[model samples]
Target: MVKCNTMPEVRSEIDRIDRELVRLLAERQTYIEQAGAIKGERSAVRDEARIEDVVAKVLAEAERAGLSPAIAEPLWRLLIEKSIEHEFTVFDEKKKKIASA
Candidate 1:
């Protein structure tokens, strides 16, 4: 835990954490890409069962981390939605390549 005595320090630490969060999101995206590769259709990109499972896990983790589920749920929902969009793009591009080949 970092203790900050000034606004500049607090802002700087927040910025640093934001950067780390983005990096982790990027890392998670690699697995999402892998999922796209393994899936047979764009429709598979949005798995309601998986979404519920993920949200459950995220909610649990947020509770453990002392974060509000109110915040985590919506944020994770948006992330999942954007990820599905990315997976659809990846799926379509792969389909195009296969068709071309």
Candidate 2:
């Protein structure tokens, strides 16, 4: 990470980071869609145990990466929630297509 000498430099770095974050999120979404397709049932889309496991793993990684739990925990929870919602949508769409075929 470059040390920002001014507010403009800080903003520029933030913008760059935001772009990278979006790209990474898009990649993650692809896997979420694949999961949607692979799961056998709609009830499997939201796994409580898996959600907790993911949160635990992310918290551990955040500790190692020096990211504050305050930020990481809620951020990941929301991200997971949104991903599950997207997965549910994908699952429904696939099921609809299969039924019509």
Candidate 3:
């Protein structure tokens, strides 16, 4: 881990990490869109069972990463909700393309 000696260094490191985080998020979004394309119904976008499964997985990963589950759980829940909305949009657009074809 890189040690920071000043506020500027800390802020710079955080900015760098945030950029990497966004890159990872974009990669995750591609898979979410792929799931939308594979599923037949918009109703499938919100899978409660799968959500719990994901939460459990994230909790475990958080423990491994030394992150607090208290924080990770809520953050992931929001991410999942937003991802579902994005998936729905992708599904609708694809359906429209197919119907028009």
Candidate 4:
């Protein structure tokens, strides 16, 4: 992290971080879509055990990284929820394609 002497510098660094985050998220989304395709059933898309495991791992990493649980926990829960929703959409679309074929 770079030390910023001005508001513009801080905002610039934040903008850079946001762009990087979006790139990483897009990469993650590809894997989520792949999981959707690989899953044998729609029911498998939302795995409760996996969600808890992810949250636990994220919380541990957050603690190691000094990020606040108040921020990390809720942020990850929402991200996971949205990812599941996206995976469902992907799964359904593939099913539709197969059915139509």
Candidate 5:
């Protein structure tokens, strides 16, 4: 929604889009939680290649939408890293079970 003309007319629309991103991130986290449950004792919660795939796919969409790919990449990278951390914490179930045995 960035005004390619540098006008403020598109600012509100951009803000709306940003809010949508927040909601989408929340939705994505819910799915990540489910993935953790399904991983079930696997010590590794993240696949780096999968993250790369995500970034690549998102960047492609951004480009197609005429948004700056540069702006999107770092934003998604931070999101992906946070997801990995959240998933990894739950994966300690495997570690704990191994230790207690």
Candidate 6:
């Protein structure tokens, strides 16, 4: 048998924070969907400046939180690339509809 140290008092707060994190992620997805709408009017270009700005913000926040900026930068880059792909998909679908009409 293994004995584990546990703090029952703060566990509820941690659980609440986790739920909030999930909620924020869902909200973020909605914004990504809107990003697709925005892309429809813009050029089909992978804006490196946008990506750099996102990376800088993520790294800065991670550093402020006493976390590893190195890991945060790469992780954020991955997320930004995925978001761009999502926006492109939206733009492509909208374009098709416009062409077919």
Mark the 10 consecutive residues where model 6 has the least summed lDDT: 1-10
The candidates, ranked best first by TM-score, are: 4, 2, 1, 3, 6, 5
Q: Is candidate 2 or candidate 5 better by lDDT?
A: 2
- Pairs that collide in candidate 5 are none
Lowest lDDT 10-residue stretch of candidate 3: 37-46
Model 3 Cα lDDT, one tens digit per residue, 1-101: 68999999999999999999999999999999999999998888889999999999999999999999999999999999999999999999989999999
TM-score of candidate 1 to 2 decimals: 0.96
Q: Indicate whether candidate 4 or candidate 6 has the larger TM-score.
A: 4
Clashing pairs in 4: none
lDDT of each: 0.93, 0.99, 0.96, 0.98, 0.81, 0.76
> How many collisions between residues are there in candidate 2?
0
- For model 3, the superposed segments whose C-alpha errors exceed 4 Å read none
Pairs with backbone N, CA or C atoms under 3 Å apart (clashes), candidate 6 = none
Model 1 ranges with Cα > 4 A deviation: none
TM-score of 6: 0.71
Which digits, one per residue and each the tens of the lDDT, describe model 6 over residues 25-92? Answer: 67876788777776647475378988898788888889898879778877778877877787788778
* Candidate 4 lDDT score at position 36: 98
Report, for all candidates in order, the number of backbone clashes. Answer: 0, 0, 0, 0, 0, 0
Off by over 4 Å in 4: none
Instruction: Show where candidate 6 strays beyond 4 Å.
Output: 1-19, 41-45
* Residues 1-101 of candidate 2: C-alpha lDDT, one tens digit per residue: 89989999999999999999999999999999999999999999999999999999999999999999999999999999999999999999999999999
Off by over 4 Å in 2: none
In model 5, state the lDDT of residue 14.
80
lDDT of 4: 0.98
lDDT of 5 by residue, 4-101 (tens): 56546577678788899899888998888778767855655778789899999999999999879889999889988899888776566645776799
Q: Better model by lDDT, 4 or 6? A: 4
